[model samples]
Target: MRVFATLLRRDLAMLLPGGRRGQSLLPFLFFLAIAMLYPFAVGPDADLLRRTGGGVIWVAALLASILPLDRLVAPDIEQGVFDQLAIRGIADEAAIAIRVLAHWLSFAPLLMVAALPASVLLNLDGSTLSIVVLGLLAGTPGLAAIGVTIAALTAGLRGGTALAGLLLVPLATPILIFGAGSLARPDDGGILLAAAISLVALAIAPFAGGAAIRAARDS
Candidate 1:
């Protein structure tokens, strides 16, 4: 328990905004940039913006989430942090599980907060904004999970960073589909489905990530 807390704190420090890597806010800013540019790209069509804006926000969020995937586990692996944790009898699964939480904390909430400005930029109405927020809250965990898992899997590989981004797109597309789909349709089921997918990912990430780390450690 104490060890987990310590690891969690370390992760938070490194992963949080303005941390050592200096890339913490990249995704956040990237998300906003897309939102801001979208209005200009599409021209001054209020109805068009209102209709497609949610999907655009969703796409922006997906891309932003990928920005940090490369560093998600590679840095820790390179620094022998995982090796030390193993020596200390802290299982990789536990470490990855904590990392998942830290990962989600690192960007998910900030993205939700950023969505406020994004909504304004895209001119989303109250109901659409509500759906967007709800969908993001339920879906970002899965994004974090997929990111961590892919990071673990590719930590030691050549071009792992590029590979991680490529891998993230397909894995996270479902979340994007349902989350963004909710905005297009008048149904709340999409949000619910997105939440279910997130729960499943959260449940499976620790074990899958743990195995990947072990494989990487051995090979």
Candidate 2:
């Protein structure tokens, strides 16, 4: 338990602002850029923007989530961090689980906050903005899970970063679909489904990532 906490703190420091890479705000900035660009790209059709803004935010969040995929596990693998963890009796699955949690913390909350101003930029109504926030809360964990799993899988291959982005779009599309779909339905079942998917993704990521890391280590 103590080791997990220690690993989690290390990952947070590495991923958060002023850490190693120093790009902690990239996801937030990229998310807003997409939201801001949506208006100009589609012209000033207020109703169209309002009707679709939530979906646009969903897309932007999904894209932004993948931005750090390359950084998630690749560097650690290259640096033999996992090898060291193994010597300390820290299983890869536990390590990856911690990474998944840390990754979500690093970016999901920022995107949620960014959604506020993005809602204004897209002219989202108060109710719609609420739904958007709800959808993001439920969906980003799954996106983070998928991101970490893909990062582990593609960590060392040539052009893996681009490959990770490509892989993420498809894997995360279901979350996007259901998350954005929630805005259209008052039942809120879409958000529920999105949340369910997130749980499943979260459950699977650690084992999958650990296995991938082991495979990478062996080969």
Candidate 3:
């Protein structure tokens, strides 16, 4: 627990130079603005807005998540923190898990908060909003996990973000399917299935990411 807290603090410090200036908040704000603008760009009809809301919000969330992936592992690798941690007897698996958690802490909440205003703009109903929030709560961890692994794998590469996307988007298909599906059938078993898939992804991501990071470090 203490190790996690310490690492979390270290990550936060790295991410935010000054606590007063929230760094990742800008991306979230941009996500909100862009999501809100979609309806206006499409049309003002409430029915049209409602029909498109789920996809628009989900796409926006996915895009917003992409913005943070480069920051996940590059800085640590560049500054030798990753190597230091590797030398400190922390297992690569555990270290990657901690890093993913830290990434989630910084990025997922920003997406959730940003989603709220976009939800209103999209005309999400009570049930749909709850499902969206729940899906995000469940799914973003998976995104962060895969994202951390991809980030680690491409840590030193130029244009890593684009590479990461290519590697990650296919992996993220399940997440997008279930997450968006949850919105379509909030009352059905689909939401539960989405949540289940998320948990499974969460379980799978750490080990996958850890192995990738370990391999990257070795090579």
Scored by CA lDDT, what does every candidate get?
A: 0.91, 0.95, 0.75
1-219, model 3: which lDDT tens digit per residue? 787778777767655423332467756776898887998898888888887787787777777777777777777677777678778877667777777777787778878877788889988776667777878887888787778878878887899989987888887778888788876662646556656776786787778767767676777
Worst 10 residues of 2 by lDDT: 16-25
Clashes of each: 0, 0, 0
- What would the C-alpha RMSD of candidate 3 be, to one decimal place? 2.3
TM-score of 3: 0.89
Q: For this target, which candidate reaches the highest TM-score against the unseen true structure?
A: 2
The TM-score obtained by model 1 is: 0.97
Ranking by lDDT: 2, 1, 3
| Candidate 3 lDDT score at position 191 | 54
Model 1 per-residue lDDT tens digits across residues 9-43: 98998898987766999999999999999999999
